[model samples]
Target: MLAAMPPSPSKPRNGGESHIRDRVRDRADACPGALRLHRADDGGLARLRLPTGVLTAHQVAVLAGAAERLGDGRLGVTSRGNLDLRGLPDDCGLALAELLGEAGLLPSAAHERVRNMVVSPLCGLDGRSHGDAQAWARELDALLCARTWTTALSGRFLFAVDDGRGDVAGLGGDVTLLAEPGGCALVRIGGLSWRVAAGDAPSAALAAAEAFLAVAREAGTGAWRVAELPDDRPLEAAVTECLAGAGVATSAASPGAVPVAAPPEPGVVGDRAVSVVAPLGRITAEQFRALAPGPGGEVRVTPWRGFVVAGLPGRAAAKERLAALDRAGFLTRPGSPWLTVSACTGRPGCGKALADVRADARPLDDAAVRGLPVHWSGCDRRCGHPQGDWVDVLATGDGTYGITVRTARRDNDDAQAQR
Candidate 1:
């Protein structure tokens, strides 16, 4: 069983790695964890990582209770399957931590920030996936919390576990595990991949991270991601060496691109799952409770700022649950104008915002956007925007806004309208 551990003292860096530490460029990653509250314009913000986005109904109620009593009476979902509780008092850190620890949310204080993992939301429920990514996530998360050296990893580091559906592999994780057919898995770092037995996937993935840390320490560039590492280092070779040292057997495989797959549409998924999205990725405490699964069921928070309630008895139960969620003001079906629309925390909540983007977005309709996955930003920072080609609605000044279509090759201004 996972339990909370006290903070451990920082270990000393070796002479060779310490010498190059001064040359590191990227500043320390200060991403907030459950214990570390980030002070925002609205109030203190606490981000809790949910490995594989698994949360019991009781856990959901606990979080909702915490949000109502400690911070703002709402919850925000991140693209990485994490929850953000905002508008908290400055001194609410201990209270928040206590609430989370009691609910089994904070497994380890030292490893809280580094426990970032996102698995396919509809993995086993949809019956489209080959293996259980959630199981791998559980194993990997426990392994991460047990190891002390993993605390050195930045909070931004991510692990994407795909059940061969390709849904999360393209989401960009520092280390990725893609479940393949015939009881095997592919462990990928950047362009390189090593095929290993399904049972060894988690260990291989951990070894990959260990290798990256070694390479990063050698380069001493404070690189938080594999893409940021120096070009000269052969990361694939390092990972292979680590895997061998860890006694994980691997087979040769060519470097291949990660598979790309979009998230499931918002509605009933298959026979036992229901997918729903909060309008603009924000929901009130009552609305959050409405998403709770039945006893023994689990809710999987999607990377697309949505929720997937799984483990239903059958199709009828899923439809009934979906109807209840739809009645609760969640976007449960398709054709909802807010389906692809999103906005940042603008106005009073965000000091840098030029306008209340959410308020401004509340009035728009299908005609307002010509494409899907449109995002409204308070400014150029464009926080919480969706990936891939989409419309960018940027707040300019006064009541005016700028609209542009962004693609891989070009940015074309489509219109300028008033909010």
Candidate 2:
């Protein structure tokens, strides 16, 4: 099963007592970007946002080379379709930026961090999707880069473009565009949704984000996302007004109209692509090279911390590529324990971590870790833990870890808590 990203809405902790904190923000988000590197225990960390997670083989080779020369040789796959380069020297920001710019990965430095978008990896490759969500994401990315005001959006803010297949619609995007069967798309923000023409979907999403900025300014709450807005300040009406003013006709969509589907499993997707994941979302330099496609081959990064290599010649060719990746230490097929296991950078990399969670988790391949998802975290933040019911293995300062089961549904808490 594909591990879920942390849910957008907070789940109650310590027996459903409501662990929700103040939604108002007090400071600017220090989220790292290609231009601004985050200082980590290891070194400076740079994140390159791949809008729609589309990367060329040449781009992949460039990133791998940069990781080897400037940072750690391993590339980190984040929950969003972004890449993280850790263990970099303090002065390598300029060098790294230069390399990414040469590779065409840095399109606009001003909007580098705000281009946080996730698109269904198998959108057009497989005939399952109703429309090409990746195309829409490209249009939206251009729009975001052109608008200076979008720079104010928090790096944590996300946008998802899902083909009618529903793979990415449930990814907890601040703004989501779900393609429908009738040449229209469902634009959603928080709990509200509106239907718009497929051709106008990208603009509608941009308009929705613009409306949120205005509402957030009016509330004076320093809210970074729609979910963080105060109860009294809803974004529904403002988004509606923005859509109407932009000349985009929208009709109210039923909650049932929302598409719900699981993420693409690791294997041959349809007949033209293959999906795979590295154990614990860590891709070594050699493995990264193995994932590089030919001149114009597309590699899509999935939100589940996986890679979807699409546009293969055929299923046999896809399987051959999968075999090559499997030989390079990637989990090319499902059923491996690593498929359901994930851990954060602990000990040496994260100053707050109590232990080396990745080291602790790497040995579990031989262990019978089955059933629900398992996430090993270094601290309470549970940084990249999966959503819904999960086995929480938290480091406890000592060599041991505190184990617990977290369930999203209140009614299933007792029944689902295995440990």
Give the candidate number with the greatest lDDT: 1
Q: What TM-score against the true fold does each predicted structure earn?
A: 0.88, 0.89
Residue runs of model 2 more than 4 Å from their true location after superposition: 1-23, 362-369, 409-419
Report every candidate's CA lDDT.
Answer: 0.82, 0.81
Candidate 1 residue-wise lDDT, 1-419, digit = tens: 11111112222233223333344345879898888888889999899999879899989999999999998999999878799999999999888888899899999999999999989998887778978898999999999999998998889889999999999987778899999988888888766678888899899899999989888877777877765564423575678788888788887665666788878788899898899998888899999998888877889998888999988888999999999999998888877767778888888788999999988885355574554678888998888776567788899967888887676334212110100
Model 1 spans with C-alpha error above 4 angstroms: 1-24, 362-371, 408-419
Q: Tens digit of lDDT per residue, candidate 2, span 121-147?
A: 888876888877989999999999998
Q: Please list the Cα RMSD from the true structure of every candidate, rounded to 1 decimal place.
A: 7.9, 6.4
lDDT of 1: 0.82
